[model samples]
Target: MIKNMKWLLLVSLTFVACNNDDSDTPAEVPVVAGSAVFTKYIALGDSFAAGYSDGALFAKGQSNSYANILSQQFAAAGGGAFTTPLMLDNIGGFSSGGLQVPKFPTRLTFIGATSSPANVPGVSATPITTHLTGTFSNLGVPGAKSFHLIAPGYGNLAGVFATPATANPYFARFASSATTSVLADAVAQTPTFFSLFIGGNDVLGYATNGGVPTSQDPVLGDDITPTATFNFAYNTLVTTLTANGAKGVVANLPYITTLPHFTTVPYNPLTAKSIGKNNDAVGLATIKLLNAQLYGPLKQALTALGAGDRINLLSETSTSPLLIKDETLPNLGAQLAAIFAPTLGAQTAGAYGAIFGQARQAKTTDLILLTTKDAIGTAPTAANSGLGIAPAFPLNAFGISFPLQDKHVLIPTEIAEIKTATDAYNVIIAAAAEAKGLAFVDTRSVLAQLSNGGFRFGNFTMTSSYAVGGAFSLDGVHPSARGYGLIANIFIDAINAKYGSTLRHVDLALYPIQYPLTIQ
Candidate 1:
């Protein structure tokens, strides 16, 4: 009770910084539009533009998206109304195609000091089957890649039921036509000024899935779009948007590998408290047992195979890194089986060799994905069941007794792959912005700064830390409402710098660090 109370107090203190000035009277500030016109503003991009936070997009999240915030500021400088395809309720996610899982799940909420954000506890009311009328100024669709913007039938309702499900559920709800593309719908609006912050989802999908290969994306739209594919798609969209003399601001993609989704879960999380769940004695005993039965034999076998440094003895007083499967590592299973077969039977020995052959303790360069944190100490039966992978002695603790699978962690090689792709993507974005003469917002460097240390907003500094950090929501991927406000200011800064406009910055302090347990 005391801990929850303290966290609640801290939450209040962290979000709302006291200015000490209670005066109601406000000072009038002068503003100017300079050379840019804001009469029909349109926002086009992915989830960030639509204001997705806490793992889902809800009513309040859309209201506070950077696009909407920027639109409101644009309104002050002669911009028109910025309408959004608002969801039906505060709880996000929606029922689509009668899928059992309801397509997307409900939005996440923080209740005091929980280990992770919990669902808001209800079914999402927005149904993809039901269509929303009206031409909205905000044409941002979640889960959209660069190529998806120009791909026709991206909004087709029938595509949602196709074998691969070609259409996006978010777009299927509000698309102007069954065959209209996201860019086509935006082009129809004919905006005088616009904002495009896309191409992150191209890399985001693969990065979030722990560098899953582009070919096998179990999660649809989770594959990394090829560099050439992204280059052509981005250029095409920019060219079409600017073809009609529409001036806009374009934000570049960030290195998503540094986001909280990839960084929050430390490589070494096996501490005394975590291992035993607040019991030091039991944890020490378990550690001893694991060392004697697992580590000792495994280390001996690996060292004999010229890989002694792969496994290390656990220290009772220190933290231990989890054993993870690195696909890039050379398989030593056959060699390991021969060595372990002396004491253990051939079948059991072979199982151990097969599981740990390419496995090693996670290093600093390796990233333990945020979603994989909870599955650390649990048994891996449900996933690996019937695969003939389990050892004979019930040594099935994930990341402890058994190595975590490829989906659970991103090794150095995978990290390099994502970074390389992001670097190439950024070059294309910068080149497009220059060639088109559009205002450019370097979101890559901005997010990098946020990850390295923290981003300063007045007296408070917001880090990208999960759950508690003001910059990111519980999901660890999308930014919080306050983070979106900071992003809005970033766009305004670029717009002002490029076009000599004097757009007013939104008050970052006014935005909440995160939505409360219930938005309604």
Candidate 2:
């Protein structure tokens, strides 16, 4: 917290220093009568910028996306309309804050809680998830990796849009089946100012898998997109954006683990039966180290297996090892490592036992190794029970419930890795924007401020409160509508500063976050 304060102070100093007494305002871009006027804007990226959350996509949520909000201001400043594929849902009402909701249900415990895990009253039956199509100004696909944007038939990917059926309800509304992906559609539009927010999902998939480097196919290797692929796609995306006389901004990925989503559910050692609560914090630290070690070895094993073989392994284990079939687990570590270098076995199994021990003390038991069946379904017919991670309940043994606090913060080493990746991505973005002479907004710092320092939105002062506050949705990572609007202002400020555009800032007063202060 002190470090953040120091950083904020530095930023304030820089801002003051940069804006000396000389107040020579720059000239604005001349406007004419509806001349397809630009700054022609196009937005491309993943979910956060896409505005995906809260059971529906509507005017408020759509308008909250930085891209859409910026486009509105840009249009007002003589830019063109920023068209995005809209995803809408029907209206519904529900009651929350009741006794039955069951207090926040730890972390992984929510797996079998219900489809609508919010624990609010009534059934949530509106179309919750959706996809985009046609000429969408917002190319931010919810689960898209950098490469997924250009992948053929990406619209059909089950993971991209969450719903019971294969096709997204929103996509089903407008698109029968898209011939071209959203990226291609945007490129064909010949935009003048394009914004790219891609590459987040690239590392996100790996992180979500608990940093497992495993893949789906036995023939294909390393399911996660490598650092190389991320760079290449980012460069190509920028190249295409600039090819059509478009000049614009691109955002770099955030340290995913820092967000409340990953950090909430404190690692309580007592829960795992390794240590008392007094030593929980220390144990948590140890677990983080072990996770990095495990992730490194997993990556090496995948690389040796080759792409085809790796993909097969991935099919068996994506998020939890329990999902993998027993037959598949036997083939998992060896066949791939054998193809690459069987010597990799040295890093397997008890490779980081000490670290695991420490983590055990900390209560982060997601790493505890149980047989695939034990992890997946109920207590292996009771013959093999009372083992694996503590609190080995009948439900968890059956894979019916998710483990609480299963996720954790990025350890120092992991944080370093993330920073390196973020730095590389940011440098490329900075260079591209500089080359095109476009406004390069530093969104990372702005996000850090919001996440750390509470920001005011009219009557309500929205703050990032781990899991409780309305600022962030249930996921604890993504922002609520008001949170996104706060972000939109950062983009708006950059546009105003660079292009001498005087677009109106969003009215914080209009959208007040609901924070009812109840007397306990």
Candidate 3:
């Protein structure tokens, strides 16, 4: 800016000279450890700590993790070598050890020309069975919750296959022993200073799975950890970490539902062009067929049953909302069946009742998951077509003719549940940090700012708009490497304020937003 101003006006040259002249630049603030000890430091948390980006936890991503980023800054102080239990290759998920795809899926790559992201055609090279031989400073298990950090057998290799998955594979790969917990290993290092960032996975699961309350994911369990449970686990961690007089920092949980994963897909994305794949004429025909065969009759029957608000007629000019299953709504399938049975046969009426009972058109307040974008106009398979609708009705289309499943959309009721839990968790986290006198990071404010108009970082403005937003990766859930750098800066600021440390924030411009399609 100064250079440009100087060029624009000859009078500004004197001002620029007064400000510059190499030696005139302010002397560098000598980095200091202050009262905080950095000789032995540890980082404990979930994926953000591990630097999971583009939907996978590869070695490069791990290296750029906030923990590692902080360590780099710490190295300028008296901090010692900070080790990471890094993946063997750039392929983020476990590629080899008998792991399966979509579960241990590979990272995503953005195609610039198309402005879209696609899965890297293979699995990660690092397998779950590949155990490390050293203790790591980065104990950021990608899917770990608060309680999981204190749970025994969380790193047991054999337990990874158990129902509900008793162990986290990411931790199992580097845990000290089968019986060791994440805290046990960290405490073993006797860290003089640390950073605690748990509790995200505790609620993220419930939010990401469309606020379904509980998840049956093989790894994270995905259940919204009860407030009491979160409090207990949080205190236990803080109590244990500070027991040895280790001064540390902790972050409060944010309302993670605001992430691109839940916010990107619009509730009303069903348009003629989308339905017809850009062929507006064909799309109009499909829309007409869907309305004539399905939506029109459903609206009439639902209206007669006092549930008219559930279905809205499709239109040709404007975007139409998606059909979603909202379990909170009163099941009106029986009522619909009774209304339709007179015109349609009993068998067909029964199918209609079972299908539309808990279904309703998605509203603006609702959030359609990013993963569901591909499934919008696609047809559901036989197994998913449990509604048992006959061939005569429009039963093939998902999110259109057929209502989306509970896992694909988050309704207002579910959003309320998540907010309640997040607020409760934040309270517990704040209390714990205050009681421990630890540096507190209001991560909620950070993410909220990004979701809202975005906060400035030097010359660039970063937002949470998924791939293009520069803050988040293609997955829409995790942040890009540059985002991690920003987080590292936040941590530095909190530490500097609380501990009187002179730690310098990393320059975010050096970080890359996304990796190449072919990771070497």
Q: Pick the candidate with the highest lDDT.
A: 3
Candidate 1: RMSD to truth: 10.3
Q: Count the backbone clashes (under 3 Å) in each candidate.
A: 0, 29, 1
lDDT of 2 by residue, 244-349 (tens): 6666766655666555555553432122112112364553443343334443344455445442222111111122222111111223434443433444344433
Candidate ranking (TM-score, best to worst): 3, 1, 2
Q: Any idea how many clashes model 2 has?
A: 29
For candidate 3, write residues 219-311 as lDDT tens digits. 857778889988898999999999999999999978888899999889888889988888999999999987887889998888888889999
TM-score of each: 0.92, 0.58, 0.93
Model 1 scores worst on lDDT over the 10 consecutive residues at 385-394
Q: What is the lDDT of candidate 1?
A: 0.85
lDDT of each: 0.85, 0.48, 0.87
- The Cα error of candidate 3 at residue 191, in Å, is 0.5
- lDDT score for candidate 3 against the true structure: 0.87
User: Model 2 off-target regions past 4 Å?
Assistant: 1-39, 55-60, 90-134, 156-179, 216-224, 269-359, 363-416, 456-460, 467-470, 512-520
Clashing pairs in 1: none
lDDT of 1 by residue, 166-264 (tens): 888788889999989999999898888989999888877787777775442212757778899999999999999999898899998888888899998
